[model samples]
Target: MSITNRYLNQLGPQLTERDLAIIRDVGRFKLMSGGQLERLYFADCSDTSRARNRQAVLRRLTGHRVLARVGQRRVGGAQRGSASYLYTLDVAGQHLAQSTSSRPRRPYSWYEPTVAHFLAVAELYVTLTEAARGGRFTVLDFQAEPYCWRSFGHRTLKPDAFVQLGVVHPDGRRRKGSFFIEVDRANQYGAKIETKLPQYLAYYQHHRQTWPDQSFPRVVFLAPHEQRVSYLRRLVAERPEAQRLFTVGLLDELVAVTLDR
Candidate 1:
């Protein structure tokens, strides 16, 4: 059965229950709204009769003390529109109101490599640079590549593409210190990084040993693809050191924002 139907059925004959359930299910309940009560049942009533058997049903279902009003709308015939109501569920009936505290998390979906992805990536990087501006990394030292790593060891380390940020001196000077980023999608393993990992490792080792005076730029591994994220989790489980030198992040959780916004 539909959610609304099930809610109505669960309400049973209690008018308060029905009213609360209907409002909650539809997400349309107001605390101080108004509408005419649409009486489903018909009963004999003259112009002078203030109440009828149908009205009595409401009184019996809800407590007779509850407040209500009568009204109608225009229709083709003189009977006017069917009498249905828009009513408020107030704090006085707090116990009868449904909770609206939480909702399920929105499902995350990856956007495959496309024009949108490319544009989005560029936009995101720019935003990140702006957000991190005036820090150690300078805008002039920032560089982005479409794809730039190659594997070169016995283990066939994977080659991961990067977006880099580096430090620049005030006098238009360039520094050897640079940080790299790797965005993984699908399965990191299946994404073919085995042959290219050595390059990254070599770079990591070189920077660490050679730059005793200056700090090496940090490497960030971002796993946005579900498969890649799963692989990363497993990779980290097997080897915790993966997170030491190169920080890992989930692309799925990264918020996408426009450059202007």
Candidate 2:
């Protein structure tokens, strides 16, 4: 038996299928907030029931040392009161997940500089999950940075994420929506962002040369606000090829479009 199975045997039978699923998601996403977990896992339950069940499961997992809470509580308005908790997989959780996964678990740290990037990616993931739940789209696959790296002989393209979406049509047909996401935090200059576009183009060209029958995924650049989106749009317009292979949108706009459509 694997070490994880042995640990579970010693811990008795407190864990449930739902608990294991939670651990897998935390392991995959690196970090997830309590609210995200509740929505993703217990969406079918009533609000009160979902909240109660989610908290109970989280508490149990934490108690078993399978998950650890990181990040400080957020103190703010009525919508987000001070009880928020960010959960990440602990050692036992990692072993359990890694045993089945082809890729090994990557290390994560909750330090200042990295926190914003992690949270942004998590927010995007949760938004996509919500869209899937609403029947607007089905998330065929989601690969984070570790698995999102692509090598093109002389160069490498590491997207923040790679998502394969099945968009639902009104006629009941599903269309494929593949995208490589580049998330920006409003810290980088427009020039810096523009420079990255050519790399995507090169990658697309290389992919087309290798597999002429396959369609290349669009490169979706998500920024903090509309102004940034507009700036990126102008940059995209500067290159006709980019207009075909790239898209720019505000984070809220992207989520809204996905959910509403």
Candidate 3:
């Protein structure tokens, strides 16, 4: 039987809105951690309550075979205690949402190496969601992975994610900001990172007319550590045009500065 059929047979009509929301988020991000879900879905509660509530919900979903654990331990953050399980929509979970098609399942081993990359992307999404909730800014639009890709004639610019932000000023005026996020894990050579800059520049130059009133989305590079962040900053500084078009910082710093501006 297909995953959807199996889930229906086992769980019957027990699914809830929260359950479906979890499935939708997992399907959308391709991967998410328990902590990210808590922030996105359960932020109103105290941290202790949030942690307890999130764990309970995740356990029930996993037990029902709706969500599959992708990693043995959490990939990001410095929180104490056992790490959160990284999650992806199970076969049954995907069928609950649109735009997701069934595909052959990969062995569990395949996800281990890519968990960090997925977590990095998830972290950015979680941060933005939190910022929106705080009322500092509103997330006008967010697109991940393939959805965030854009074609410019012969070339394609695939940002890790694209976000449209509406920043609320002290006087209560909201200004629009758009950005393309690049989550660098320091896995690529410095030269490779340097090479990617020109493609962004080209995309901005070619697409200016498309968004005449709005500036080209600034490219924000979220580096894993300070050294990588510094290196990227130096490289961006060398090119005057790039200096204006790009911003680089460690994840925590970016979260504070980007949304606050």
Stronger candidate by TM-score (1 vs 2)? 2
Candidate achieving the largest TM-score: 2
Candidate 2 regions with alpha-carbon error over 4 angstroms: 1-5, 79-83, 188-192, 255-261
Runs in model 1 deviating more than 4 A are 1-117, 129-140, 146-178, 187-191, 194-196, 225-227, 252-261
| All candidates: TM-score | 0.35, 0.88, 0.83
Clashing pairs in 3: none
Deviation (Å) of 148 in candidate 1: 7.0
Q: Pick the candidate with the highest lDDT.
A: 2
Candidate 2 — what's its lDDT?
0.76
Reference-based lDDT, residue 179, model 2: 83
Among all windows of 10 consecutive residues in model 3, the one with the lowest summed lDDT is 99-108
Instruction: Give the Cα error of residue 218 in candidate 2, in Å.
Output: 1.0
lDDT of 2 at 100: 51
Q: Write the per-residue lDDT of candidate 1 for residues 1-261, one digit (tens) a residue.
A: 223534544543455444543334222212111212322122124643423433454344334212232222234533332223222322222222334313211211223333233333444344455444446444443333323333333433232334444445568665543446555654443345433344566765665676667664455556666666666556655645555555555654432211111
The CA lDDT at 125 in model 1 is 44
For candidate 3, the C-alpha RMSD (Å) to the true structure equals 3.8
How high a TM-score does candidate 1 get?
0.35
